[model samples]
Target: MAIKYGRPIELREISRRDGATASPALDLTVRPRRNRKAEWARRMVRENVLTTDDLIWPLFLIDGNGKREQIASMPGVDRLSVDQAVREAERAMKLTIPCIALFPYTDPSLRDEEGTEATNPDNLVCRTVRAIKKEFPDLGILCDVALDPFTSHGHDGLIADGKILNDETVAVLVRQALVQAEAGCDIIAPSDMMDGRVAAIREGLDRTGLLDVQIMAYAAKYASAFYGPFRDAIGSAKTLTGDKRTYQMDSANSDEALREVELDISEGADMVMVKPGMPYLDVVRRVKDTFAMPTFAYQVSGEYAMIAAAAGNGWLDGDRAMMESLLAFKRAGADGVLSYFAPKAAEQLKAQG
Candidate 1:
């Protein structure tokens, strides 16, 4: 049965008269796809933009000279020698990368339980810093103030009686920051995840008349599984006795990361960062939104491995994926990203401009 002229009619008479005031089912007033129809329109309406200035390259340092030995887990990363590191810094300048973070691979003979090599005024990191500063005096150099690279047991803090020591370990980290500052390191990044270390490092630097050196605190570093290849690069994976869950942030908590960031900022950190970036992007966004400070994120080793591995195997276009990932950090409110793909991404951005 059908309705014709506002009355019931037989099925045979349905097409004979008007059944209804026919109209289209949907009357759409707004179409979002209009803006997405052209590349120029999409670019004009982009919410966030990523540029070469938003990248910080991390360079691993080794003991010898002229060696560029690659790590097995990390696809393209290598431990560069001091002279080679200087050349790389020059390359970074050419690429317009504002900063290059240095991580040293200390010799096994130098590592000990107390991580005393960290305080040596002439260690690998200090030497490399001096070398780079000599050639590229204006390029910002950031040194990590964690003991794991120099500790025999592969922990970021001093250990005593099967426990990670806090206050005592902070004393050593203070000296480590002092030495790096004295060696012309512009920023001291305390990735040790120890309580009150940022305040201690800041005080120590000021006492030594190095008032201009900045402190970039790894405020929300988590004991994440993504650090395996990073530990391998820094020669810590082999000797690591236990996990760092005691000090590093718990993955189960988001508010705790905000608390950690708050504490570090109160303690005199010039900048704050959330480690193992992609998984903790919400934390990154929270920290940035809450404090409105200079916030950074570390695109950790495992994230790099996943992208590089997939790209190497012809599973994806590496360049586009890398750009999209970095842009995601920007979308998450990161001021900059410490990434292994910094150089490559910078080149791509420069090409685009």
Candidate 2:
């Protein structure tokens, strides 16, 4: 029931029931509902707005030509080959999406304990970067600089004696960042959660004549339970050895997230990201308000799968949920969001305009 619009009808009914010519109204000076009485008024007073400029679409890549495989876990999302990925980039540009993030699904045959496949010059990521940049040179391409997609153990860092080696992993991450930036990537996002890696990657790029490349550190990545479907989409669900609690931040600690973000910023990161977006929005707000950097949030694969599954079951409207979820990030003070629903949301925004 529209509160403001229904109040007048209720007053008329009361006046007739009391046998009086006029209704006795309760005096009210400040009615909050006045601004929400109509859609135009609501738009005029909206505090935050979601638009195509605030969206970053994540695209998954696979090895092959002219192939497209739908991820069972992520309903509408697909694992496209280089050609199909280029076509998708074209679509993103047409929709006015400012950027597209790339995540590769490395095959098992190329997997190794050392994650050596990550540094291969002709790997799936490097090749896809070349293919997309060739046709759509103006489109911004962001590449994830993590080895979990290329590792046999499905861990982001190198492991030894049942423990993650931080400094050793940073060394490899530097090489990975270099290859992606060299292949026409505009942003190198390190999601490995390694200490001091952001500084090392920045120095590595500066030394290699790649000073123009930007770094978006996954500063506050937490080891939450919401990443299961993401592992499945990348084929890491079956290969993961154990939990990554030792490296990823604990969900119970918000102050620790601030320390992590502070360290990354001091280490020379151009931007910062909060992963598993909605659940960690407090951290997003804190990071944005505190550092004022280009703060971003990622709507993980598990979050997408849950909403998609519920929508498929006819429980709620998928479009509204997607838009509301993304808007929540914006209202929480995120500069942009990396979402699986980017293309759909962009289309919706265009229609509304």
By TM-score, who's the top model here?
2
Tell me the lDDT of candidate 1.
0.93
Shift of residue 116 alpha carbon in model 2, Å: 0.5
Q: How well is each residue in 1-353 modelled by candidate 2, as lDDT tens digits?
A: 32333575445444444535443354567889889989999989999999999999999999999999999989999999999999999999999999999999999999898889899888999999999999999999999988899999999989999999999999999999998998899999999899999999999999999989999999999997888978887899999998989999999988898899999999999999999898999999998999899999999988999899999999999999999999999999999999999999999999998
RMSD in order of candidates: 7.1, 3.0
Q: Looking at model 1, which ten-residue stretch has the lowest summed lDDT? A: 16-25
Give residue 232's error in model 1 in angstroms: 0.8
Query: For model 2, what is the error of residue 339's alpha carbon versus the real structure, in angstroms, after optimal superposition?
Result: 0.2
Stretches off by above 4 angstroms in model 1 are 1-26
Each model's TM-score, in the order given? 0.93, 0.95
Sequence-dependent TM-score of model 2: 0.95
Clash list (residue pairs), candidate 1: none
Candidate 1 per-residue lDDT, tens place, 1-353, comes to 34545655443355423434443244557868779978999999999999888998999999887899899888988899999999989989999999999999999999999999999999999999999999999899999999999999999998889999999999999999999999999999999999999999999999999999999999999999999999999999999997999999889999999999999999999999999999999999999999999999999999999999999999999999999999999999999999999999999988998
